[model samples]
Target chain A: MSTEVEIKSFIVRNFAPDVPPDQLEPDLNLLDSGVVDSLGLLRLIAWVGERFDIAVEEADISPDNFRSVDAIAAFVADARRNSEVAR
Target chain B: MRWNDDQQALHDAITELGDLLSENRAERDAAAVFPRANWDRVRATGLLGLPFPDRWGGLDQDLLTTMYVLEGLGHSCRDSGLSFSVSTHMVSVGVPLLRFGSAALKERYLPKVCDGSAIGAHAITEPDNGSDIMGMRTTAVRDGDEYVLTGGKTFVSNAPVADLFVVYARTGKAGSPNAITAFLVERDTPGLSVGTPIGKMGLRTSPFSEVSLDGCRVPATNRIGGEGAGFLVLDHVMKWEILCSFIINVGEMQHRLERCVEYATTREQFGQPIGSYQSVSNRIVDMKIAVETSRKWLYDTADKLQRGENVTTDIAIAKLTASEGNVSSALAAVQIFGGYGYTTEYGIEQGLRDAVGGTIYSGTSDVQRQRIARMLGI
Candidate 1:
């Protein structure tokens, strides 16, 4: 599965069960839409770290990074790239 | 993580100070008074700045090293309340400010926090909203260069003696993840008054009270993080709070276990040492298991956290295990000590009383379970 697809699936399954994966907009503001609360954000971050093999550091925990599916995927890709470059 | 010579030296330094810190602890606990003299001594040790940058007058130790020393503090200090206050002062304001504060803010306040000249506390829980941060009603409305804060916070650890507070108040709509904002409010800020220290079951020596912020105006620069970033700031702080605070509990449990073992073997009963019996020996064994388990969970979680892995579930489980284990270990120690434990002289009852707060503070055991369940997608 693609990064966006997997993220959408995880968010739908955990946070918005009523919303279908295909229907959940990639640009939907998860923070404002109340699709993800404070605890939900934590769950999302943890899932992202485990699923994407990215170590989400303290600096990367901004709301901007996790605001939408596309943003999260971008963050994951960027973090992976950075980790590889450092290695 | 094995500490090198320098880390061992720091840990040993604090361990040696325990004798002085614990002096008159029973009397202080009985009176429920903050030990000013001991607080001064703790300040001198620079333990408050264990995990902070050395540029800010801190010891510049890493998280694991800081926790390792804190565990030593718990093991050596008989006054659990004082140990609690020490941890609270560090994690409450210093942790957040170090992580999220601006460079100017760090330059101004980090020194005070590191030197322990200005004690720190954070106000998150309200009178009505205990564990529900999203339900917080304290609002901070932007007004020109200042944000006007009007709300009340309860159970603010170190409030009575605190010089600064990281107050979380609503900046947006309620129940929204981005609603709350964290502000660095000085204790002397107008309209901010701390209530008289409230009495509690345990951790009595660590003074906590209600903090009222009515139309208190704080400069925009005082905000710790970006507007609506209070939840994230708090999330980071809570992680440190659980690890730093509970590691002390781990230390306390280790001490309690040793005491129980010593008492069981030496204290004569029924014509032989009680430790020889399965019932008594079994309880001691369980206490031992609880100590090792709590230690393992705490350090393992810290290691994972240091590596920047997501620890939402790991932290909850660590908190639950350490907290619940502390409570059970204290109870078993009291039982093993028999009548001596029941009495106030040996401080066994006080240990049990102090242990109960572990289950409630930071996050309650129930809250931790809920967090873990949520992480499990339940």
Candidate 2:
């Protein structure tokens, strides 16, 4: 699976376990749909950082990236590819 | 009595210190310092013994007073670990001795505890026992003039620096829940050893560790009550411990809620503050509801406890509501603050970690549900 699909799967499994794979669109709003809360978001951040081997900084954890699964995946991809530059 | 003039003074004093403490929390948390100065500052404020007897230099206050002062401390103080340590000291150690200690034990320990000359801890959770108190493996064999204790207690709060500990061990019957006995074991006694503090995910500032008693001998007079009374003593004190923890979290909920509101009103997005969006605004409103309801429940529980009313159900309900609601409030606060909330610089991240431990300590949320279910005859 693509990195985006993998990240999406992880988020869905944790925050929206019942979410069907077909419905796991890239741009689906996780927070808005009540899939996760703040603590869940923290856990997600740690998971993304560990899996992608990126240093997701405090400033990077915003609605811009985490508002939707697509944004989060894209942000993670960018951070992973340019992990050194982001840090 | 409710928080009278003296209690108000104590509350105000701690709140002032809290303001200073919260500002310095990031540094203290990083360093893992025990916050001795802040603790002494609280001692000077005379709130250290708010719930103890007046004769022992305590405030002789009720649970309401204790809750108010502790709440104010939780709001003003930045170090939740330190506040937790103090709460554990008062509820788990001081209260137990006050309620069950022999007059001599009280005269010797209560004054020292009230004066902050000594820190006290309760050691009960063994490596083999977490939720199952009956699974404790510590044994205390009665020798000629003393009980020889042999076993290790894990997750002991304040074990490192405590001068006195209310240690529990099997004294009457093995594997029997009612066969345990509580003893006041002084530090430096032969065979009493404290392990290095356990490095934990949060509450790092409050030092915790294991205490092992290998042939640790203590006079028979140090026992809290008759043989096999330890479980009963723990039962009486755990309710208070649970309640005190809820009160502290209530303060944290208020603190986080206020910070989220302040951040929402300031930070702009798409030509308007992010909080202007219904999603953000509604979450903040939910937080307010949670905070208010949790506080009201805590207050009612405290009042009932102060009035000597049966508060088993009330205490359980309050802990469940406050802990779950505090998590909600912290989550909303972080969301409202966006990226800043997730960073260590903003302290919101730390608050979340500190708050997560609440769901585990005192008693886990799962255990609270079971207690409530059992209470309801489910």
Candidate 3:
């Protein structure tokens, strides 16, 4: 599987292990859907940043980027790719 | 900046154990058992030995792991009494020995404590000196090869089943700042007697009793540290005890707040869920705010402790915040549960009773306020 899919699995397992990976879509609302909430979202972001060695900017952290597992995975991948370019 | 893989694994382990503990909470609370079976599981999981050296059959885990494990236990178990018992021994008794005990003492007792073959207690409170340590009247007179101890301690947790006690007694003139000394007293000593367990308003599952030392004789070898060192030992443990208790309160508040949210969203009133009403929803929101803020403070304090930073002021405020937040959250839970909250059948009232003890024990809410006031230079 792609790195995003792998990252998505990690985030979902940390908070909501019952959520199937196949059900994760890029546009889905994790909080509104009761998959994770504000505190859980921050925890997920921390997990992503640590696992992938990328720093997430506070300004860039919002529901738009973290509303779904797929979105979160993509965001993490983009951050990693961008940091690699900067280096 | 972020948790490592080992940290993540430990966190997951604690969360899983917490869920398991939560499942047995009701039965444990109802029966008020000593939780020997649960403790056995803890021993098998190596939690009983978490802080000791790995050479001595311990996990030797960091303080962070200890904090998380206890908090997870508090979150899921809902048995404040049992958690209180475990912590009193682990911090109040186990830590002092590990940190200050002579090599001989460590060799003799550390393994037993680590294996859960023995439980421990610390005696500091006296009939006249609940919060005032200097006012304690317990005395230990030095003899040729032994010290004869004569004093009484009340409200001691784990007294009924404790195999050892790290007891404090006056060894010098009354009111002397360095008059007090600490001793490691065994349970079956001639003059040492355990009183009938006191019936408490909350945390009843943990055995608490008055300890009477009438001419109790302890060998000089049993003494911990030197003359007048008891006060220092007491001071060191208080910060740890207060913080650990606050961690428990944070966990319980989280559980109760989550319960309120679930109940509010599902239970109906007037053809719709009661949560739609501002009255009910507002209380839930308040609970969330308290839980969230207290949790933040809890983590901040834990982090500060992990770094060995100066946190006297931070810890006092955190204790006060957590105690008050727990009381309010438990009360809110009762209201949300309605009549069910009042009865033991629901466990809400029990949580309130258990939470009330937090305000009184570990230096009462009044003491916490005074500390904060002093820190403010008022």
Candidate 4:
């Protein structure tokens, strides 16, 4: 599955179960819309870091990066690319 | 879990210091005075440096070791307010700086923090926002090399005497966690004002107050982590604060239980000792249960956190259990002590007062339940 699709699946399964896959839009504002509260966001970031094999530094934890599934996937891609460059 | 010889020695030393440091606590509590002498004692015992790196003038103790010593402090120290201040000073500014601060920031500030020469506090809860940390009205605007901070914070513990304040202010979109940012502001900075201590029902000796910043300018270098990482830093700090603070409460509850057990065995009513009465004995038994359960939840949660596991639900449960358990144990102690507990001279009443703040601070018992509910996807 695509990274974004996997992320969306994870969010739906863990955070927003009642919202159907199609209804939970890729660009939905998870934080502001209350789909992801503080604890939910922390869990999501941990999942993203582990799943993507990237270290989500405290500095990298921002709402803009985790605003939606697409944003999280983008962040993961960038982090993976950065780590690859470092390697 | 077994503590090493060094950890046991540290615990015993802190217990010894507690006897000397907490001697005048009742008088200080009566006067609502902040204990500078007690802070000095903490410094002398090297406990102020317990959880920091050894290179930074610390003993480089682990989380569990630090918790163990702090639990000893709670048990041996009669001054709960003083104990609260010590934990606040350690975890509030120190935890964030160690986690998110730049190297330069650490080099300059951490030594003083470790030595207890600098009293540290965090200003986050504002008049408008208590549990809703994201809704703070404080704003920080970047102006060249400095950030201009403007806002007021309330219920700031150690504010009246703190040397450094880790101030949280809005920097990005409202209601978003990333919208907030953390800034390390010095007490000597211009436009920063600390109001006199606000009288509280409990922890009066701790001396919480209002901190107002009117366009206070702080160096950009003073910001911990990035421009919008205040909530993340606070999230980390709160976990440590809750763990350390409630573990101290666990120690206090254990002490209370011990005292109650002693009183039950000695104090007589009717023909036999009060221990003969099921009502009083049952209450003491409940106190024991509360203390043991709180200790279990605390250590188990801390262990999970150390393993890089998600402890959101576990921490909430632990915090709730420890905090509410403290209050229950304190109340039970008072009843077991009978009239002596009610009197200020015996100082059993202070236990109830000190335990009350544990439920309110570090997010209220209600907020903790809300967190658990959220974790359960409710």
Instruction: Output the number of the DockQ-best candidate.
Output: 1
Mind giving the per-residue lDDT tens digits that candidate 3 earns over B169-255?
Answer: 998656544567889999999999999878778887788899999999999888876666665556557767876767767777888
Model 3, residue B176: distance off in Å is 3.5
Candidate 3 ranges beyond 4 A from true positions: A1-87, B18-31
- In model 2, pairs of residues that clash are A26-A70, B18-B76, B18-B77
User: TM-score ranking from best to worst?
Assistant: 1, 4, 2, 3
Taking chain A by itself, what TM-score does each prediction score? 0.92, 0.79, 0.73, 0.90
| Predicted candidate 2 versus true structure: per-residue lDDT over A4-39, tens digit per residue | 778778776666778776678777666545565433
| Each prediction's whole-model lDDT (CA) | 0.91, 0.77, 0.74, 0.87
Each model's RMSD to truth, in Å? Answer: 1.6, 20.5, 19.0, 2.5
- What docking tier does model 4 reach? acceptable
Candidate maximizing lDDT: 1
Task: Provide chain B's TM-score, model 1.
Answer: 0.99
**Winner of 1 and 2 under TM-score:** 1
Instruction: Please compute DockQ, using alpha carbons, for every candidate against the native two-chain complex.
Output: 0.65, 0.01, 0.01, 0.40
Q: Which of the numbered candidates is closest to the native, going by highest TM-score?
A: 1
Per-model TM-score on C-alpha atoms: 0.96, 0.78, 0.77, 0.93
How many residue pairs clash in model 2? Answer: 3
Error of model 3, residue A74, in angstroms: 61
B124 Cα displacement, candidate 3 (Å): 1.6
lDDT of 3 by residue, A55-84 (tens): 533212244466566677777767777877
Q: Residues B268-343, candidate 2, lDDT per residue (tens digit)?
A: 9998987889999999899889888888988897776555445556776888888888777887788888788889
